[model samples]
Target chain A: MSIKFKHVSYVYAPATPFEQKGLDDVSFELKENQFIALIGHTGSGKSTLMQHFNALLQPSSGEIALAGHRITPTTKQRDLKTLRQQVSLVFQFPEAQLFESTVLADIAFGPKNFGYTDAEAKKLALKWLEKVGLPKSIANKSPFELSGGQMRRVAIAGVMAYEPAILCLDEPAAGLDPKGRHMMLELFKAYQARGHTVILVTHNMDDVADYADDVLVMEHGRLLRHTTPSEVFKDRAWLLKHGLGQPAASEFAAQLAENGLPLLPQPLTLTALTHRLVAHFKGGE
Target chain B: MTKIIIGRYIPGSALIYKFDARGKLLVTFLFVFAIFLANNWPTYLVATLYTGLAIMGTGLRAHVFWDGVKPMVLLILFTSALQLFFSTGGTVYFHWWGLWLTSTGIVNAIFIFLRFTLIILISTVMTVTTQPLAISDAMEWLLTPLKWVGVPVAQLALVMSIALRFVPTLFDETLKIMNAQKARGADFNSGGLIKRSKAIAPLIIPLFISSLEIAVDLATAMEARGYQGTSGRTRYRVLSWQKYDLLNAGAFVVLLILLKVLG
Candidate 1:
């Protein structure tokens, strides 16, 4: 089922001195198969919202309709195993979650948990292992033996092996090098293209500009804005006020406008910026 | 956060908090010893009153102490139940199916329960009022005499401080690992003993690896900072007697005397 959140609110340590409002009246609906970027400053409830995808963190108030399952504050964890299997979450620094003796076994863990047969789980694990660009020979090696990047790939692959309908990630490429980050984002983009919904929580505006079809902006645990990435950066003043950065291209376009070449439509991506510059110069000729 | 309240330090500036950590630790130790002197009803009542006064002096809500004691409640009940079932002496009040509840056992159980609870509450009071770092520092200062016996007191204090520091870090990691595994459908609850242990495998392995990595990183960081066995190191926080410490120690002595006389 398509996902929808209705007035969802979560409070940590409710009714106590240490109580904190994790999410405040967050309401939104997401279309299927779209790459959604969940953007916010730290402590803006992005991770809290991400946890609600699979009912990992139940809302204190509202109902979440996620992949045909109705999850409320009263939802039993036992009933959400299928929901979790259908909608997976890869937490930040997922490599820290790796535990199995071998890379392939770790990758196969999710599928096996989701009720796939042993053979089927092995097949899925192998497919994802290759898909994540790890060498086939390392399948038997302990995950701890792999390099940090490889370990990250294995941890990510383990979650993706089950082929969840919706995949939510919290800074999945946070500490990776540039090339590794690009490759990891490409994997998620490809997954989204293949009819799976992807929700990515990231601080990188460039990645949002490059990949996201929808952007969900959060502030003080509220969904302040839910729009396209272009729209998110369109209001530079708003972005600046909220301490958000524009994509490199958008920032460059803004600079170009200040330098007297005012393009009618601001470009949000590098290719669009190049095309805009080329057209602006050619039009002048 | 996992909300493991034992030895949790809540930020407060009550009378107990104003007292020196060393004084608090010593008083807590003396209190534990005094609680054992609580044999009969009068002594237990005096012990309870002393503990209640200490709890009130902390200026923390009663529930905070309750939260600390809540987890051990089952164990406490079980221990008390064992005392009820065994120890055949005095009047046999009840007998059923190889179980005996004698008057002596009943009194013994009540005393044991009071001792356990009073000790726990007093320890919790000291812990909640005093910082972990302060506790470690006070421990080092209190064990100063052991330096003459060739004990590595400073190094021991450093290790204790580091271990105490990692409690919250490791607790958070445990939670993170558990949630990560749960997302992949690793059922921690609702299983047989074997099923549960199997589920815990995913959690424990990750936690152990991460903690090892953390310890290594900490060691490297400490070495890089030239932490040479605390030699030529002056205290950033020197433990000293506070104005309220004398009063606290005096009150504790009064408590012991009261318990002794009442018993």
Candidate 2:
């Protein structure tokens, strides 16, 4: 289902001496099966905005509609719990949230809290672990014993076990090696393949360019632009002004274009860049 | 949901800071004991004046010194009222509803209240003047002798230091969780006790989960650094008692004896 926020505003430590306005009249919508990437500099309210998607953060003065149901402070407990389950959130460092004795138990925590039977929860856990490319053998071991990447995989498995319609990941590939990062992105691609709506919050422009179907650029608690990757990349000056780095491959293409080579459309990936260069030499004939 | 309070200890280079932590600890204990022993007006007056001067010497404001007294206000008032009604052996001021207020009772209440206020104020001075890490370091060093008795003093101090560090982090996390739950239409404010408590359930679940994560990260960091229960570890920061500490301790003891003799 789609998630909608109408004019959301949030403040950290409201009315206290430490109070800081984190979001200012922000509004956006995530349509069903849409893969959106939220990118901004640190403390630009990107995290604050993403938190609102899963109902982790409430707007100080706006309304939210999840799956066509109006979300309010007086919403029923059962309804809120179900809403949270539908929009699963895997935090930036998922491994930090591991607490149960075994990977299986940690994965089952969310489902069990929502009243899943033990046996049923275990079955779901096993399936999600495999879905994340981890084996069932890792299920019974303490989550603490797993390597960093494995821990993250199990943590994602825990969220995937809930089978949310909307999967919101906060910096999923953060702190991973290059290979680990690629594997994690591939997992999100698989999730998208299954027709699940994914909202990925990241700072890496390359990740956004390679995977994000929709890109929303935020700067200083303000949404500067919300459009497709091509549209966002077209505004090169604006992106640079807001502390956002351009995709490395696209930067190279732009440099080539400056050197009297017309690369019609800048390529963001290395493979596409290679193809474009080959065509330029062939087209020279 | 651990109702943790922030620790006092401002870090700065000052004369009071250079003193050994063990010396400071010993001196504080002696000062508190001496303050408690002052029985009469002259002794109490002298103790209060000395403490007030010492508080000013620390370069902290009077407000900082008074913070310790704030939390004990209710207890001080209660104890005063109890003394005014229950203490006997003096001229009676009034009698009503099985309660008697005597002249001695009034004196006792005033004395006890002043004593409570002054002592709390002095302790507040200690907390504000010393850095918490420094104090913990001092505590660990002083308790090293207890290692022979299998006392995990260093470990205890490490736990305290870590807990203190985590307080602000956890508080920020708690606020985030609360706001998130609130966004989902969970009313933490404007509800009955049960309803408010119920509303906090979702927030607490995530907060606890995050805390577990924090604990694991901290443990991993500790393990990575070769921490294995503080055995045979040489401290980077060493503390030493100086001549000033010896004089300070002796002066305090002499002052206590003088007060007792005069009383």
Candidate 3:
């Protein structure tokens, strides 16, 4: 197993008036190279669960085994250093974490921290900068001077430069325009295509339908469901009751079926929905 | 993390919470002054009991008070220990290797500890009972006289309030940066003093940059909302003195006079 959480739970500010249950008896397993989408409403403990993957947070109860490291409440901080190098998390608004003087230096910061030499780090930074679609000429400028989208790209490149075996992102495409969002999602998909695990926490069901292979649904700090996107989105009424929206294609397919225009199966993606409609029209002809 | 009670206002319906922020601020100042004025054991005991009563009156939990005192435990102990060994007076209770533990030393240490505890407890009670905005408003009102002398009192108060408000926000930002760096294999623990300080550079730089960005954003937002830097602003929540505020102030003066007479 690449990642396994066995009855894990977490509480924030335990034993105080502000104490809150952030995660409740969550248990799941994720295999290697799987593109997993973690979906939940705000404050549903999605971020808290993702932080456990890299040992940024330890489970308050039970245990988690990620890439062979068994993490419990008593895990030593020193043991997490290697785990962090293997599982990198790109937090929300990660661009704000850029602090190096130049864009190149900022991108190289991660690789260098992970033991890459100056020249090697810079080389990797240059490679990833281009891969993230930024020009080499802007590498020497301050990241703060860049536009919002460019800064996000630079920040993402910084994490990608280190190239962890498992990548976890929290709302990576949030606040981006459609094009930027598409580019970001495509970049992550490409990363997963290279045989690496990608765990994405996002609210966009369309992105889930198009990209994610497996889906983990969270509700009120509990793991309500863990299945494929097709399976999870198929239960439209259940998803709606849980305050989750279905993919547009699936909802439209459901409406069409309700109107007596039957599709063979629910189409989750635009291409699948289009193919189904074309076949229906040909059959009518 | 829960132990961080400073700058956090706990809501309550106690008399202390009901008193005006201005009256509370003045009383806090006077209380701190009264603490320093207590040089004898009797006076320190009275101050400690009074501060304890004041803390209980605020309706804050006992542990919250202990949380504030917890960090200062070591300092208090160290100071008391120094006084216990070095202070020379009264009958010697025990004689050790070139050191005498005397009655006066014991009394002095206890007096010092009680004084420190009382002062810290008073301040903690004030901060916990009064909201930060109320404190800032009180500060602005108290500093209004400085405007005649050309001090930007309103601006200063605004800056103070903003800074106070961002304390928790910046704390969270620091945690986020630290987590980001840690994910990159930066170890904050397990290092020498210099190494750890160097590791902190990653956290501090991001924090400073992000704080500047947040400041710029806040300024833009304020201007967008037509904040004229106190020149043309009208009060939304105006502060008015109540009868309890006068009673509270009167009670503090009475306590001060009583302490003087008894001590």
TM-score leader: 1
lDDT score for candidate 3 against the true structure: 0.88
Model 2, B184-257: lDDT tens digits are 23456666888777666666766887888789998999899998888787877666668767765665677777
**Candidate 2 falls in which docking quality class?**
incorrect
Q: Where is model 3 more than 4 Å wrong at Cα?
A: A257-262, B1-8, B11-13, B34-48, B61-63, B66-116, B242-247, B260-263
lDDT of 1 by residue, B1-263 (tens): 32443358888877778888889888887776677787889889888988899899889999989987998899889999899898799999888988999999999889888888888998999888988889889999889999999999999998998898788789889988999999998889987998888889999999999999999999999889988787789877887787777898788888788878888
Supply the TM-score of chain A against the true chain A for every candidate structure.
0.98, 0.95, 0.98
The Cα local distance difference test for each model comes to 0.90, 0.76, 0.88
lDDT of 3 by residue, B1-263 (tens): 22233376887899888899988888888787787777786676677777877888988789889987898999998999988988889999888987779999998898888877877788788888889999999989988899999999889988988898788788888988889888877788867999998888888988998898899999999999988778877777689999888878877876787689777
**Candidate 1 lDDT, tens digit per residue, A1-285?**
578999999998786556888899999998999999999888788888898898879999999997889999898888988899889999999999999889989999999999999899999999999999999999999999999999999999999999999999999999899999999999999999999999999999999999999999998899999999988999999998886889999999898889987876889889999999899889889
Better of 2 and 3 by TM-score: 3
Q: State the lDDT at A119 in candidate 3.
A: 99
Q: Which ten residues in a row are the worst by lDDT in model 3 chain B? A: B1-10
TM-score of 3: 0.88
- Between which residue pairs do clashes occur in model 1? none
Q: DockQ, per-model, please?
A: 0.54, 0.12, 0.48
A-chain TM-score in candidate 2? 0.95
Model 2 CA lDDT for position B186: 46
